[model samples]
Target: MTSFLDEFAQAPNLKYLNHAAVSPWPKRAALAASRFAEQNVLLGARDYPEWMGVEQRLRERLMRLLNAPSTDDIALVKNTSEALSFVAFGLDWQAGDQVIISDEEFPSNRVVWEALQPRGVEVIQVNLKGMDPESALLAACGPRTRLLSISSVQYVSGLRLDIERLGEGLRQRDVLFCVDAIQQLGALPFDAIAAQCDFAMADGHKWLLGPEGLGVFYCRAELREQLKLQEYGWHMLEHMGDYSRIEWQPARSARRFECGSPNMLGTMALEASLSLLEEVGMATVGKLIEERVLWLQEGLERLPGIQLHSPMNPARRAGIITFSLEGHDNQVVFDRLKAEQVVCVQRGGGIRLSPHFYTAPKVIEETLAVLHGLAG
Candidate 1:
């Protein structure tokens, strides 16, 4: 519907292009969160059942978003790091087992693997600067390699990997695959099933256009129980409501990973945000985002002393476009943009501009005009 595009009622002077970091929620999500707060203040937990319904819908939306087999494969976690820890600490690791990853991964992806070093598990950082990144990553999967962990799109450089290629290559080597999908999940179309990922996780606050502190984690069904439970509570019990029962086991579904009460406030907002994305359809969303990214790419390339750090190939990126001006320091440029009310971030040794599907053309034009002035 045409009305869906109007959901974002941002400031007229604001040129926000920082979805790769934290995004401002649309009007609908803000309203949903407001209404939820009112209900809590007036009625307390009296309508808790209805709140649970919203949570369920959130899981379903995430299930469809990830192309997961079922809602049973999805777990609402605190953030990407928590879900990564579930897989990092859950798996049984042996001495000399290697975990291969890219050299450009965010600290969240890299530090987790490196932590396993004390257990005699080596973390091999593979350079993806070569022509064929997938081949370089797979070549590192020697006989002792047990898993391959990578980000769907590198956060800083905005280099999108061929997940299908990596998935197939890892599968052939009998290696488990884990994807940190925070950068790609909401910017473009992603498939956990197609990628054959044993585990995948993403936070809601970034390109999902939702609030912080809530995220989704997907684990393949066959490997569900294989992950040893590190946390336990009433919520994760198979019989969650049996208050008087002593005997309990983890839920047979992915709910086993949820250790405590849900973040109901975050649930309401993210669910509403997801509804908007569903209405637009991810295919259309991806196309619109690519158009915007390409526009930024072209505009920045034409500016004097501009150099792009992100991939120039259309097929090799998502919504992010990182670039630098020859005469300007990254922090100084970032401060100038911030003072001008052009919301963007300095990352990957440059300024990272990420515009979403609903970003107005005027925003891009005006933001580029600012950069044009700075370039002069």
Candidate 2:
């Protein structure tokens, strides 16, 4: 029997610790894409109904992954930005309405709300550097605060917030909550319903172990029709298959967000990738990821002049661990690591290393050894 680790066949000398940015697909995902390409060449859409079944399975998997209410809440989006745009532009905003976000958000999360400035909607940036980041965010909400959009885990610092707590607080305040869950969804166990997020989105290329250009968007069932439709096509219509119908409405489900054709190629790869995650179970996956992150943290802490940037508390961490050498430029350190085939990135004034659940012990050991040499 082959081990689950065997699913990943990375190069012998390549130490890939960049799952936070992009993940190499599992063998199953590759094979699924290959089979899809072969089928396309052999018979052009002859089995398109079977392809649609694969897409449905993908939605079901994503629904389970997010702990969403139902598959009705899941939307297959092009990327995280598109989903964010749907919320940003779809909302009914008024002058003086404000959206609260952290200062450390990725561009997708920040820029979307800022674009609403033209409509007199204010974007408030709260600093998450304080001891109680959740408290800071909650306090920032006032009468004018319309929504609170946050990342489940900070991308650069790997600071995992207590989203359940925030969710409860937002509910009491009657404020809508949106979470950019790209950094946490696959790396940890994410519960959309428990978190009480009105909206959430994440890309498949990162910790999901799939290709880019495809992602999951979850909208609360109650708010399905509340969001105004910004895009329209045959796929998003209520009478989707009835092309002869003169009048139609947007889908009653979250499928309303999906306009035009689905990315069948991406659907094939992501569904197969998600199957591996399901087989492993997210609880086990999250536990193993934590173990790897903690192991990396311990090794980095032992290095001379190492400065840790990610959260030290285990409860406040996800899969990311970032650090910097005391006297080395971040870019220089990143360049050195890149040249050594120790794949990683520089972020938050430090080097960011993200290891997934199946990262080999050898990869971790050798990466530490290389860092030890650099420290010396």
User: How accurate locally, in lDDT, is each candidate?
Assistant: 0.94, 0.94
Which residue runs does candidate 2 get wrong by more than 4 Å? none
Runs in model 1 deviating more than 4 A are none
C-alpha lDDT (0 to 100) for residue 166 of candidate 2: 100
Query: What TM-score should be assigned to candidate 1?
Result: 0.98
> What TM-score does candidate 2 get on C-alpha atoms?
0.99
* Ten contiguous residues minimizing lDDT sum, candidate 1: 1-10
Q: lDDT tens string, model 1, 269-314?
A: 9999999999999999999999999999989998999989999998
lDDT of 2 by residue, 26-71 (tens): 9999999999999999998999999999999999999999999899
Q: Model 1 lDDT vs. the true structure?
A: 0.94
Clashes of each: 0, 0
> Best by lDDT, which number?
2
Q: In candidate 2, which residue pairs get closer than 3 Å at backbone N, Cα or C atoms, i.e. clash?
A: none
